[model samples]
Target: MIRGEWQNPALTRCDSKLAFRSLNQAAIQAERASSRTGELIIAYTCFDCGAFHIGHADLSQQLAHTVSVEPGCRECNLPIPEAKKRRARACSAKAIYCSDRCQKVAERKRRAQRQMASVTPQ
Candidate 1:
């Protein structure tokens, strides 16, 4: 199934391939393409434009080397799953937190700390 909408060739560098500005957008298209085509589709970052693109998961071997060591969440120190690790590799972004709740808590703590620092008298 066709995954994404067509764009000007100048923008994508190719008339056939579709480019997504974010991993989340590419991932959503990948899911739809996977479901329709019955293939393991995945979102990957393009080396040329740094935009995300969709392709077969098996093609990942040509992209980049997978991380050997498992990483833990920064906020809770919990181990991240292998699936998440794969997704992180595709996007070139590390998974800092295991869940959204942990990320939110970390953000709140940072905000509070900033507020406290700003309000304190010298």
Candidate 2:
């Protein structure tokens, strides 16, 4: 979650569609109760828990704030394939995987290497 004054423990987690619907409903109620009705919200997946969270910021703006870096597959050391570049752009600044498959393969390899290292200690 982006750190700010808006962090709340009560924020419910939901999928993108449901979250937008709920945000709309809440915004409607808030608008009805208040004089302003320009309330805008966006849903983003929380990096901490892998859950969706809603925030009062534009998606493009939030994405713009992210500093994109050249990414490579940790397991293969291959520069992100051309096909995956677009997908990589949408990922978080710290994203490690060019794709889900790469992530899983890297994780499995890491675990195996760790086990081998542990069994062959100097």
Candidate closest to the true structure, highest lDDT? 1
* Tens digit of per-residue lDDT, candidate 1, span 1-122: 99998875556464468889899999999999989998778888877666788988765653443457666898888988778777878999987788779889999999999999899686
Collision pairs in model 1: none
TM-score for each of the candidates: 0.38, 0.29
Clashes of 1: 0
Taken over the whole model, the C-alpha lDDT of each candidate is 0.81, 0.59
Q: lDDT at 5 for candidate 2? A: 75
Query: What is the per-residue lDDT of model 2 for residues 60-121, given as tens digits with 9 covering 90 to 100?
Result: 76586568877577766666666566565677445456677888988899999999888965
Give the Cα error of residue 120 in candidate 2, in Å.
4.6
Give candidate 2 misplaced runs (Cα > 4 Å): 1-69, 77-93, 120-122
CA displacement after TM-score superposition, residue 107 of candidate 2 (Å): 0.7
Instruction: List the lowest-lDDT window of 10 residues for candidate 1.
Output: 58-67
